[model samples]
Target chain A: MGGKVTCTLGEVKNRADFIVYWGGNPAECHPRHFTKYTLMQKSPFLPRGRKDRTMVLVDIRETKSAKASNIFLQVRPGKDFELITLLRAMIKDQPISEAQVAETGLTIEQLQDFVSRMKAAKYGVFFFGMGLSMTRGKHMNSAALLTLAAEMNAFTKFVAMPMRGHGNVTGADVIMRWQTGYPFGISFNRGYPRYNPGEFSTVDVLVRGDTDCAFIIGADPGATMPQPAIDHLAKVPTIVLDPHVTHTSKLARVHITTAPAGISAPGTAYRMDEIPLPLRPALKSPYPSDEEVVRRIKEALLEKPDWMGERPQMLQNQI
Target chain B: MDLKVIDHATCTFCGCVCDDIQLHADDERIHQAKKACVLGKAWFLNHTAERKYPDALIDGKEATVDEAIAAAAEHLYQADMPLVYGMSNTTCEAQRECVEMADHLGGLLDSHTSL
Candidate 1:
């Protein structure tokens, strides 16, 4: 199995001579990615900044980010997995025909050239976005890309990192890993943390009607989740905490307006590269912070009966 | 009117979480967001200190924060399987509270990463 091999944004700024944006349009989504960290930053290693670096963009369509790249490869929609697999095989000196390459909307010459560039670069990095991870193949596509990045290490220094979406998500992942020993998709019904993605994931649980109630904070899933999941949230008694009146708040049984994080709420938020930064709030809102509301909810729950029966505080062994 | 300048204010609109933004704000609203991108500018300019919406709402009707909290707890406690979800737009402190809430309720805990 291929595990994640990545470095901090500072490493990318200093050492990455070759950078690839796969399926992500960082120019618009993460505006400072190029100017502050990747292509435009002048470092000790990359003295010329954007002049010394090479950028490659691979996406189904031509986004604004393509303009910033030296080479833009327009891939066929839903063919990310196939393209990644071909790259992996090519990197290993395996055989692949032109017909197979054409199926992914890229010619054999383009892939061959891409492979040569991959092997020739001193330091390379891939920044994949939701366009790759949330596509038809989903995790399979992500895994393939990670595998390709790992394989490239044979010839040069290479790494891959996901361009995580919106506000302190990386913090949640990092914190959850520390507290529950799992990143996400966790259940504590058996008195300990249990991890399972498809089963315990919020969308799956809501779509299946397995959850009778939902406590939503920060995210507006009513506008983002699938119709069935949204319907289930409406069916159940849902509670929402957000600074503004969002789509989720409209359908929620209870909506508590809270101060927006990093704006009016003081706390920590992790960058996509897993760097923790302290939030310096500039304004004060009349509403409570999400932290206070969640803490109050927890205290309210504690006032009631104990849900865990005879289970010990610490689990001797995880089943 | 004098505006307060805050340097190194972080923008959490996206994953990059650019922390070098300089914000100029009064007590009511942010006047200018220097070194911020278009998205970051919109993010800072949109939210204000002035009261815009109700503090709490139960079934679309205005309610007290205490009443809303009690109602929320009652609903979650009464359910057989409750879900604590969506930590994407909040702080780490709130996220920790969410995890604790799930553990205490014996419920499902998830974040935007699972989606």
Candidate 2:
């Protein structure tokens, strides 16, 4: 009752009749999302393509993607959780006052119509974005959306997926889950992987100044992270591996130029739907690939004495 | 006007990772990226094979990749709590290496997803 119910983009393209874009603007942030993967593609189930599908966009403000949606619901800023909760209750046929729904800036009638459409659709999908996951209530907002998608399955096929941005972040998540049995925010202090979000998350770790040294690759945290976190990275001995001299590279103690992924580095990258794709490089680069540099760093570390002198190689259970 | 064309080239600017892009490139840079959106085109055309920066830099001074690698390893090895962060733009193979480095260093590992 409380797990993620989702499918690959192909399934979404072929089967989804009701598409709800929550807190995401595909038009600008992800330009090819609508045309390539979701709304425009014609499948046997949805032969008419755009005509056969219903796209509802829910966000705090109107964006270019709204032009493609059949309906645009602008929820009050920071009220996504309230609106989602109200919908959850309404879907269960529970009595809810219009005043409560009004606080979310959407009329009860609109929500009722939305619920009916969700129930009637052959396949429904909720593509939530950073606007939901990184906003007020954070993970709770995402969990609510996922829960709603899971509950909708009682009446029809429904699923939810995060509109993951940045190159190969989903790849990193999938790989971390495979290697450490955790997605992100991992700590290896005990000779085993431990998962903790607030405690081990990069921002929190840097803000807290808990880490002594940092090894960065592919991302420029100096430009993105909070000021305190940025300050801490500058204070520490940071090593950066990137294609360009990025913001983080400027602050780092050491910067190694690595070939850019998907452009000049050949390897595997995962799409937002966790679909693995082969990266074909179009140009040759003077720098080494990230994989080669990281492997070299790992090998350099291995040549030194083991920090972990005597400990169990594996643990049956992690605390 | 002769340019090398790569079909089925994937655009990694965003999560969609559209793999049907056709990239027309020369020895230095990509001249055209067909079937790519505005963002994808910028992503593909912005980077080049040219060595825009030094091969490696230490304390803001130019250095060899080997020296930088050794410096990075020494710094990470000497720390009590080293951190391995940022895998959003790299390949999965490199990500695996980062994770392995964290495990070996008994450090914290995180990604842009955490932000």
lDDT per residue for candidate 2 within A1-319, as digits (tens), equals: 1147989899998989999999999999999888877899999999999898999999999999999999999999999999999999988999998789989999988999999999999999999999999999999999999999998888899999999898899999988888888999999999989999999999999999999999999899999888999999999999999999999999999999999999999999999988899999999899999999988888998899886898554431221
Model 1, retained fraction of real contacts? 0.89
In the order shown, the candidates' DockQ scores are: 0.77, 0.78
In model 2, which regions exceed 4 Å deviation? A1-3, A314-319
Give per-residue lDDT, candidate 1, residue A165. 87
Evaluate all candidate structures by whole-model CA lDDT and list the values in order.
0.91, 0.92
Write model 1 residue lDDT over A139-248, tens digit each, in one string. 99998998888889989999999998898999999888878889999998988899999999999998889999999999999999999999999999999999988999
- Candidate 2, backbone clash total: 0
Quote the lDDT for A44 in model 1: 88
**lDDT at A253, model 1:** 96
Pairs of residues at least 3 apart in sequence or in different chains that clash in candidate 2? none
DockQ of 2: 0.78
Return the TM-score for chain B, candidate 1. Answer: 0.97
Q: What TM-score does candidate 2 get on C-alpha atoms?
A: 0.97
Model 2 per-residue lDDT tens digits across residues B7-97: 9999889999999999999999999999999999999989988889999999999999999999999999999999999999999988888
